[model samples]
Target chain A: MNVLLPQPYLLFLGETTEPGYAKTAFGLRDWSPQRCLGEFSLPGATVSTGLPFLTPVQARNAGARAMVIGVANAGGFIPQTWIGALLEAMQAGLDLVGGMHARLRDIPVLRDAAMQYGRRLIDVREPPAKIPVASGRRRTGRRLLTVGTDCALGKKYTALALARAFQAHGEAATFRATGQTGILIAGGGIPMDAVVADFAAGAAELLTPDADPTHWDVIEGQGSLLHPAYAGVSLALLHGSQPDVFVVCHEPGRDRVLGHPDFAVPDVLDVIDLTIRLGSRTSPHIRCAGVSLNTAKMDTGAALRLFDRESERLGMPVGDPMRGGKAFERLVKACLA
Target chain B: MNVLLPQPYLLFLGETTEPGYAKTAFGLRDWSPQRCLGEFSLPGATVSTGLPFLTPVQARNAGARAMVIGVANAGGFIPQTWIGALLEAMQAGLDLVGGMHARLRDIPVLRDAAMQYGRRLIDVREPPAKIPVASGRRRTGRRLLTVGTDCALGKKYTALALARAFQAHGEAATFRATGQTGILIAGGGIPMDAVVADFAAGAAELLTPDADPTHWDVIEGQGSLLHPAYAGVSLALLHGSQPDVFVVCHEPGRDRVLGHPDFAVPDVLDVIDLTIRLGSRTSPHIRCAGVSLNTAKMDTGAALRLFDRESERLGMPVGDPMRGGKAFERLVKACLA
Candidate 1:
């Protein structure tokens, strides 16, 4: 399925707002924003942060057919002050898509303007109307998960890399994004953590719904087995995905669980063992497929050495996925072979 | 706090319907009929279910201050045909409470009738307004969880028993239910399973909200660790409760995971270990404090013998909670001490 918007002129709204959407803005820029004609900000912007800033008319002149509210604010709320600018863009005949908690469609003024102008106002964060409670069915297919030793430690990056590797190997594979960053990258996904706890797995199950039997669903994991604040989300994902195999994602030489010093990150073997057993508690077929190390902290040589050493220890595939190593690719081939 | 209704004068509506709310009806009767004036049915009922059947006026005459719509229908829908009788009850000054998928308060006709009579209409299955994402805080004071091998294997009963046992010992303990049956018994609780998945744990956390450090919270678990159809609920509950200790509730001699025969019940030790580790993944202070065996399948002697053997194996107190055994009480004491 075509998940991302087709090749079309785009305008990013508020790329330079106070308390900037650094994450969303950086993601859009990385996704190649030359495709975006320019960005729109308020009147008095002192510095250009690389990307060109424009007004509504200028954006329309640049052939911008769509406007993306490119900021994820605290609680996903869009300030009322941005409404006038958004309305002006809508009046300029550009459809709008936003990932805000306060739905643009719920605002009568903007919704009415969109209706009047025959423009679409899409809220990316709108939840599915219905999600069946997960059955933990051990469904057929090579479903792989990227679990982590800690949160923000390369689970999403590993999943994306592996999806690319699997596709290159002439296999049917899909990257199932479960977080905001991955969702932004993949173009469409239920922000798993943003979802209500009961539906976290349901969302995962929905995202990875019964595909072709030969297809591999590389689900992006969230939180960590050891994260004090957010482990429930991980547990739900683990159970919901019911993956046949999983890849452990970890940043080498991490002293403690991310954001919490009280919880120490355990050995890679402990993480693997914990993940495999937890994943299999309901669906007994689940196993740890391999390990993906995020060795960004180490030099390339040290990272490679650590990968080789961990590979010997795990006996399964292991590698720095970002560096395009052989270990994770081998793990995928071994599972699908 | 008063969990059950105070000196309830209840009228059971539709006691003899084709799709009988036999479970609910039986539960209410078991809770005691002296508490219920009688039941109401259509005029010509074939057989009596012991509780005297009454019409609207007859129910009011029997001192029925509240009318309970008693059919736990397939979809929990109160049929349109039953609405007239319910309106009649409401008009007769009887407050209404129902456990149904469709909220009676949301039904305009019933809502209007309740308003006309100045009576309270309650939908027991309604979820909490907002449940914050669980932070997995290792809070002080003891929190005990009742996790079962399968659904309907007496997780609720074990929790209730433990709460009473703790209260009898002059300790402050509360029974927090996560299902309809438990809510009916508790008078108030967010139905965790029925809640939107995102809010399941939040609901649990809300129910057992941070209380006085000296209070023990006995949380009634839902679903089971092994049940494929509903393990997500179990996992969410495990993380949401963040219990200092947990009690394993299992029905001895059961070969399968309740309804799904394909999934066999695993060893008690496996369940205990998995529950403890999963619960503490985020909050490391949690542990398995004891085991409560639903030994209804065996005589007291056999049950005690099995408990003793299992207790010795696990090195924890184990017993049949219903039979008033010492193991469960001792387990509570050990955890709280």
Candidate 2:
């Protein structure tokens, strides 16, 4: 299913992860958006994650009719300071969309302003539809899951990029989002973390329900097996999706688990093994198909080198999907085959 | 908190696990029951896990004013076959209580029958009270958690038994239940698995709110790290409770993970390590205090031998609480000290 938003789109990328936003916004810009106006961020932000920041007036001038809250925050709360800018965009008659835990429509002033301005308020964190409890029943279609080394480390990015690449190759592929950012981009999948625990897996199952036997359900994973704060969600996704093939996603040059500095990053092989073991609970034949690295922080040459090194070490297809190469696509084709 | 049930109780132990029901009923009978009139099962049911089967009329004759559904079924569904028996007891003017996911009131016939008879339909699976999302806040008190090798291997039994032992030793200890059976016995405590995944831990944190600094909160555990069907709940409980010390509980003779024969039972030390690691996400200094073996199936001599072997190997206290011995109690005292 396609995400419906008014066009052209203005993405709000808070100063946090500029490169991550740029990748997500641009990724969606290519796949879903009719046209991209520009990105927005706090003033004096040095990071260059997504597209360059556009003022609310500039966004209006660019013919942007929808404002997307693109920044992914750890706390998930959209700070009050961002409200004034959002209100301006809403008044500009741009429909508002956000992936934050705090709903945009939940803010009384924002709701009233949106109502007055005749603009839609979309809370992407809220499931677009009701989700059912997963039966853990075996389905006919093949599923590919993007397991990650840590949160915000590009599991969704790899899944989305691979889905696009698979479609480009004329294969039947669907992207299943399991988190807020992915839900915002995918336009229809449930936020697995926000769901009741029992249904977390069920929601994942619902995303790619009743597809052709050969259809590849590319599921977006959340959290990390090695992540201390959020492994329960990750495990639930692993068991729920019951992916036949899983591509391990990681960020190069990170020695610590995300948001946890004291804990050393686990070996990628260990993460792969643990994920497969956990995934095998629901699907006994589950395997690690490849590795997708998030190398947004590195230069293209260095990123490719790291990719090749990991590829040689794990003896699996490994590459940076953001490198604008067919490396990840090739891996996806082999795994689905 | 103690579970207050209307007397006299007639426990419904179906054909599933007679030994299981007998154990659970007898455990509660020892801890909280005013008196267990007798256990009831279908006629011709050979297993004598608990008290002998009593017909509804006979149960009422024996002064059973309440009928407790004693079987722990997967998916928590009370089958239609059992409804007839339950209805009979309900019409006999006995109150009804069950821990199944299917609430008794949802059955129209049962509801009407119950209404006609003025019987109280107590669905123990329902949350007894409102639960909040866990704040992961550091509250004053010491919590001793029961981390099991798998579910229904007697985490609650060990916890309740240990709590009683602590009280007998003149220590300020509270038994915090995290599942239905324990909740039914404890009178109040959140059903951790029934809770939303996000708040599973928070609900656990609320169980022993504002306790004395020196008090020992012996929290009942649910599920296991190795359990394929229910590990997410286990991990959530581990992280939410933020126990100062965790006691690893296991069954000595079990060779495979429950319900998943393809999976071998993980090492007890591994379960302990994983729990400590997961629990430390909220409480960094958390430690595995000891091991509690559910050796109810073994003879006392063999159970004590296995306990000795494990205690020697782990260099920690290990014992069977069901042995009517003080081995586990001494371990708890030493760990808390």
Candidate 3:
């Protein structure tokens, strides 16, 4: 499907030139990226902060739609602000596509987990439409929550906590709709066989199915390429509930959240904005919540630094800081304002 | 495990004692008329219906506990209330379990589409704690919904919908915790395999392992039974959101709502009043949302008439009326007031 990327997109097209990325590419049906340079035009902003010299400059020079990637290993999770900056940059209307290592074998944890879950790991030549309901009514003023990292790195808890926080704030927040939950419904009841079947379903259904868990059965968005449920649920709940804002909590998988670290965490800031950019339009009042990697040997201040740096990087205000609960909460109010 | 029954309680004694009732005892187990002779001396107000003939004295004299058991038919799906008059005559508590042969065999159509789904013959055995978390809460001055019925009738939906309606009405309710939502947190998550794998080592973060659609996994409530996640989510929301008023909804099932007609339906009023009966001290103030059957039928007027007849037979004031909406709602408000 033609993924409608938001303007001013900044995405890295990593070893995508390789066979792995191309094999999964939709448009590259019979052909690969090598056969089509500048043959396709970006619908929006595309930024690449990871590859500094060779890839970014080359793609830009070749008029293949590009922006440079950046990073730093400062925060625990990727910084949310950095992604915001990239999104702001994209508003100038760029085409953004995410790129990374082509071979699954190259990524250890990713490979095994993908196999265990029975999902695919593709280059996503043409990103799937995360926002399935593309309508004026569908996108505006809808409640949105970005959850579950591509790698199950504790995103679930973060999503639940934030959902609670939202309810605390009187906003109806739920665990972002998930694929498994949909499958559970399709499979006739929660996964009772799940080792912690009871616990998982309990957590999800605790607040009344719709109240506790966002509807992801038919919507799409908010997950890696493999599990389409993430995207589907996102679309469904957003269509159904239609809240006023969107908040994302993240722990960048690599150093990308801050923009210059050697590691490869998806920046919380960029990812959140990329969500709307890659899939759907969030209410302008849309707010993002960041859960930084505060402990992983990075400076405690690394998360905050990513904010300031990304502000300079992506071009949005140092989106209000949520220090622990205080800053995070204030940011929500700010978004509402 | 010892099934706890009140002392001095009435139960069916022997087949010889009640010639017609003799052949009716379930092969699995049945209370004897001899055993029924002694009431389980439960401390509190006697289960009086103000009808002298309904007195426990005569019931005890008959060497039967003031117990009521509905007659069964070889056919299928009997409404427990069919024996209303018989129950009122003895002013006894009855335990009658029944199932649907035809309906159970039919497949469920969602959004009303058939063929895409396959139906299986379903038979459920009635087990104790059917309406598991029926009454009693840690708090007071708050309204409580007292669910009265054997298992698999309308308890779950009654609890959930009543709880939901209360929340809708700005009342803080919990199915698991006694509150506005009248929703119960029984049967935690299904404890499916998919859920176990997902949480454990991020096996795709899938929720539960698969199960055959035709058969149930039938385990005695494992996975966070003591501390349910459903209750956890709802309670947390209540704690954070703090609603007003609590009205419990009670749904009657096949054996109860559509129970065998041979026996007179129990005083519908009393069956709905079960939570209060059990919670004698607070019986006067508890709010009951006499439930509409989900897995049974959806006739508000009919269900209400059935309940009203039971109440009148037992000599209680006739209820306003049964309704899917406003009619039942009026009674709910009056009870709390």
Could you tell me how far off, in angstroms, the CA of residue B98 lies in candidate 2 after the best superposition?
11
Which candidate comes out best when scored by DockQ? Answer: 1
Q: Rank all candidate structures by their TM-score, best first, as comma-separated numbers.
A: 1, 2, 3
B96 Cα displacement, candidate 3 (Å):
37
Each model's lDDT comes to 0.72, 0.75, 0.30
Give model 1's docking category. Answer: acceptable
Q: Write the per-residue lDDT of candidate 1 for residues B1-337, one digit (tens) a residue.
A: 2124432545454535563455665555654456667777655433244687676677777677777766666777776767777878878778887777788888888878877889887777766666665555556666888898888878888887788788888999888877776666665677776665555665666677778898998899887665555666777788777788788888888887655566788788888878877777645767777788888878878988887898898898887777875766677676566
lDDT of 2 at A1: 36
Native-referenced Cα lDDT, model 2: 0.75
* Candidates 1 and 3, the one with greater lDDT: 1
Quality of candidate 3 docking, DockQ? 0.07
C-alpha lDDT of candidate 1 relative to the true structure:
0.72
Give a tens-digit lDDT track for model 1, residues A195-282: 6555666667777877788999988988776565566567778877888878888887887876556678877788788777767765
Q: Give the 10-residue window scoring lowest on summed lDDT in candidate 1 chain A.
A: A1-10
Q: Indicate which candidate wins on TM-score.
A: 1
Q: lDDT score, residue B293, model 3?
A: 33
Q: Candidate 3, TM-score vs. the true structure?
A: 0.23
Task: Name the best candidate (by lDDT).
Answer: 2
True-structure RMSD for candidate 1: 4.3
